[model samples]
Target: AQSVAQPEDQVNVAEGNPLTVKCTYSVSGNPYLFWYVQYPNRGLQFLLKYITGDNLVKGSYGFEAEFNKSQTSFHLKKPSALVSDSALYFCAVRDTKTGFQKLVFGTGTRLLVSP
Candidate 1:
């Protein structure tokens, strides 16, 4: 089965420091990977995706990810984090065979960025 695993339940970091939220996945054949962030009660905001291309893919809010096929990982990264960047992050994988774009998301990672 296609699945995404976010090992960390929460990540705390000082403001302006680099940040990372780990993610690992398993899928049959090829798959689409995505990252999204949610704030409070609001819906998830799309961050990035790795369809197929170079190992490194960039996204909004100065975030990026490196798709490592051998390791079956796609960890999110940011050079300089901000207090405002704090939120709940979810790593997901596209279940294409389902014939729907339904995304299987991780439990979630709470990003506690402190000033």
Candidate 2:
């Protein structure tokens, strides 16, 4: 079985400061990882993904993630965080070994960027 873990329940940061949300994953075979952000009363928005290729993957809203194979981690990062970036973030893993590409998601990590 595959699983994702967001160790921190919440990450507090001041506006304009750099921020990071941690995520680690477990899988039987090669892992397909993804990050999603959700705003109040809104669906999850795609942030970034790591299927294969470069160790560092960039995504929307000045966000990027480094895929660390050794640590089995894909932590989301931003040089500067905005108040608008405050939201609930999720880390997911797609189990390609199964017929259906079901995504296993972590509990969630809430980001609070204060002005």
Candidate 3:
């Protein structure tokens, strides 16, 4: 079975400082990894994805992720974070080996950015 793990339950950062949300995945085959952010009273928004090819993937709102096949990790990063960036982040994965393209999501990590 495919699974995603987000070790940290919450990440706290000061505004304008760099932030990272760690994610590691396990799958039978090549994995399709994704990151999503959910704001208060809002649905999950697509942040980035790593389907194939590049090791580094960029996404919305100055967010980027590095896909490390060796480590089986895809950690989300930002040069500088804003207070508005505070939200719940999730890591998900889909196993390419299976015909069913169901995504397995992590528990979720809450990010808090303070001024």
Best by lDDT: 2
TM-score of 2: 0.97
- Candidate 3, residues 15-76: lDDT per residue as tens digits? 99999999999988788999999999999999999999999999999999999999999999
Model 3 lDDT, residue 17, Cα: 97
For model 2, give the 10-residue run with minimal summed lDDT: 95-104
The true-structure Cα RMSD of candidate 2 reads 0.8
TM-score of 1: 0.96
Against the reference, the lDDT scores of all candidates come to 0.94, 0.95, 0.95
Rate residue 65 of model 1 by lDDT: 93
Better of 2 and 3 by TM-score: 2
Give stretches of model 2 more than 4 Å off.
none
| Pick by TM-score: 1 or 3, better one | 1
Where's the lowest-lDDT run of ten residues in candidate 3? 94-103
Best first by TM-score, ranked: 2, 1, 3
Prediction 1 global C-alpha lDDT = 0.94
**Highest TM-score model number:** 2
User: TM-score of every model?
Assistant: 0.96, 0.97, 0.96
